[model samples]
Target: MKDIVEQNYSSSQYIVLIFCRLLIGWHLLYEGVVKLMNPNWSAKLYLMDSSGPFKSFFFWLAQDKIILPVVDLLNQWGLVFIGIGLMIGLFARLSAILGATILGLYYLSHPAIIGADYLLPNEGSYLLVNKNLIELASLLVIYLFPTSYKIGIDRLIFKKHE
Candidate 1:
């Protein structure tokens, strides 16, 4: 009876983990595809012009004159890579970390961009903190649970290395 119960619990855990991975993966993949398809789908205008708390910060960044290009490239490539990684479950942990990091930066850049008002309750900007937090949590779960066992190429690669 104890063994059976333990087995059931383990199976349930895997199911939940896989579900989370799939959900996040699909979401990221969709975002990447959208951005890739839209050449003018730039966040620069929002980050730099939006009347939000981080507007000034983004403005400063834009005018930094040194890191603007690098930041722009990072933003563009980061989204695409993160989306691809999540979708394929390749180096999922690394992808998750990178995604979370990017999200975190966005959150810091404009905590009010989404709807976050805890710190400053106002219809200012979009508060991306929630999104970042959720992504970070999902990343942690992916890192700990490793849902690549079922449908990811990581399995074959890991086996080969072994």
Candidate 2:
């Protein structure tokens, strides 16, 4: 097996990266848990509110009786798995990628383009960038500059190989 190269990061950098990982993970986990606990919770309203180029696709996802349930289950479990994986530093890179993918879909569904409006009011003004985009970028950063192998559960698990 090819060896993994070690990269040195400053203490502050490590702290910030780890903090971002944990925070995003917690946020995803909370969202998944809330949806799971609420039996009536569905993505219909949100998907129906989509206003971007992919609006039609989102609407279809929310409207299709057969696919809707599958989508809901995947969203719920995907969030839970990705969140836990990130929080625990197990498959952190993969988790970040998946998290970013979900965020990307959300961004596409409700892009902050000119003249675009959403039923959900924006807490802050945005031109072409919003919280989802920002979080996606953060996840990308986490994926590129991974710390899991150094300080997360990955460290313990992968240590044997190293």
Candidate 3:
């Protein structure tokens, strides 16, 4: 079966998809930049505060001095790269998948299940659904619809090959 859906989407559909992509990209980029700018910023607290079934693994990742640095670097850079790719519609599908994966990891580590609490306060209350999951779903939709090649940098990049 084909992975990406191919269709002649209406202008409105394209507009909505592009809007979503840009918004998500901006959010990711902002997060990455904030982390990058702060020398003291680290995922240690967040990982240590994890409360899901994978709590042990996340805690291990946070406590490991060697691995922690690598993890912090990858997380920050990954967000930046993914955000840029999505914003410019360059390798958008890959960006969407990567974004979803990162968000998935976040959601798994801090699930919004009942009675679960964390050191980091949530902006809103949730129960089994939250912004991370919503954003992850949005990325999945972006991946499935894939409008970058039609209206993004991908258009120029892939047009030469086509």
Candidate 4:
């Protein structure tokens, strides 16, 4: 009975992990492709403008000019790399971590785009918490589980090892 239960649980977990990988991969792919196709679709305008929520923070960063070039490069390349990695399940854990970090930074910077005031009682404006939180959770889940093995290059590599 115990063995049967363990097998069932493992099977369920496998299904869930596969779903997660597909969901995350597709989302990243769409976002990266959109950004790549539209070079003008940059976070700088939304993030560093006066109308932006974190206008002060972004303005300060621009003024001080600390790591601007590195940040810019990472912002561009990181999205593409993370998207590709997730799509192919290559270094999935690392990709998830990097993706989560980028998402967290975006969340922190904005936080008032969604307008969910009931759940979070803030004075200024409501934050886009739901999608960001969900994405963050998904990334963490992918990091914890071995989703790459289900339908990814990791499976081929590990098969040779075995």
Candidate 5:
């Protein structure tokens, strides 16, 4: 078996990374729970309000009677699972990547188009970028570092064999 490579990270680095992980996880969990509890909640409006060149694709998804429900289920569950995984530092790399992917799709759906305004949650305004993009970047960083290997569940479960 190939030995697992260990990198030395400062305590401050671990603190900051774990903090980011927990915060992002909490955000995802909150969103998922909100949507899950609200029986009337639906992403239809969000999709319909999508802009940019991919507006039609999103609109199509919104209007699709068959696919919309599936999307909803997957979206909700995806958030919950990713949230739990990240929060617990279990399979964090996978969770982070998935989270980043979802965030990317969100950014693409609304796309901080220049001179364009969206009816999204009050995150203020931007010309060609937004909170989603920022979160995606953070997720990317999380994925790259694989903090789970340092101070997460992955560290406990998967022991390195020399």
Candidate 6:
């Protein structure tokens, strides 16, 4: 029997996935560009304000003068590259994984876990998980479903045997 997801999907499903990918990609791209445009911009504040379990590690990264710049550079470039990859449907799975990793870090930094209070301003209220977790979950969906075959470079590079 064919797998459930392997069954034919309506055009809407494909379009929705494409739109989701585009939306997330656009967000990542915009953020990266903004940071790149401003040399003084750094992830230091976010790192320093991190709460929950990884608080110490994140604080270390934020305060460590030597490592702070390196972290900042990687964070910016990772967002740019991952954004481009997702927008162009190039190495989408890899992009999704990378994006998830970035989001996971962000989520951990300002964890919305129940009963926890944070000094940082939040985009929205959440419990246990926030938009970051939601987006991360979306990336995981994209990774598993792989609509890249329908509208991505993966279609050409990873041709499936009939």
Per-residue lDDT of 62 in model 3: 98
Give lDDT tens digits, candidate 3, residues 25-57: 999988999999999999999999999789999
lDDT of each: 0.63, 0.88, 0.90, 0.65, 0.86, 0.84
List the candidates' TM-scores in order: 0.69, 0.93, 0.94, 0.70, 0.93, 0.88
**Residue pairs with clashing backbones, model 4:** 111-127
Q: Count clashing residue pairs in model 4.
A: 1
Model 4 TM-score, all chains together: 0.70
Tell me which of candidates 1 and 3 scores higher on lDDT. Answer: 3
Candidate closest to the true structure, highest lDDT: 3
Query: Tens digits of per-residue lDDT for model 2 on 1-162?
Result: 114327788999899999999999999988888889999988788888999788999999999999899988988888998999889999998999999999999899999999998986458889999999999999999998888988898888767653
Ranking by TM-score: 3, 5, 2, 6, 4, 1
Q: Which pairs of residues have clashing backbones in candidate 1?
A: 112-125, 112-126, 112-127, 113-125, 113-126, 113-127, 114-126, 114-127, 115-127
Give me the overall lDDT of model 6: 0.84
**Which window of 10 residues has the lowest lDDT sum in candidate 3?**
1-10
**Per-residue C-alpha lDDT of model 5 across residues 121-155, encoded as one tens digit per residue:** 55786867688999999999888766777778887
Q: For all candidates, what are the clash counts? A: 9, 0, 0, 1, 0, 0
Q: For residue 123, give model 6's deviation from the true position in Å.
A: 3.0
In TM-score terms, which candidate is top?
Answer: 3
> Candidate 1, residues 55-114: lDDT per residue as tens digits?
677777777767676676677677777767766777776777787787666666555444
The better-scoring model by lDDT among 1 and 2 is 2
> Which 10 successive residues of model 6 have the least lDDT summed?
1-10
Better of 3 and 4 by lDDT: 3
In terms of lDDT, model 4 sits at 0.65
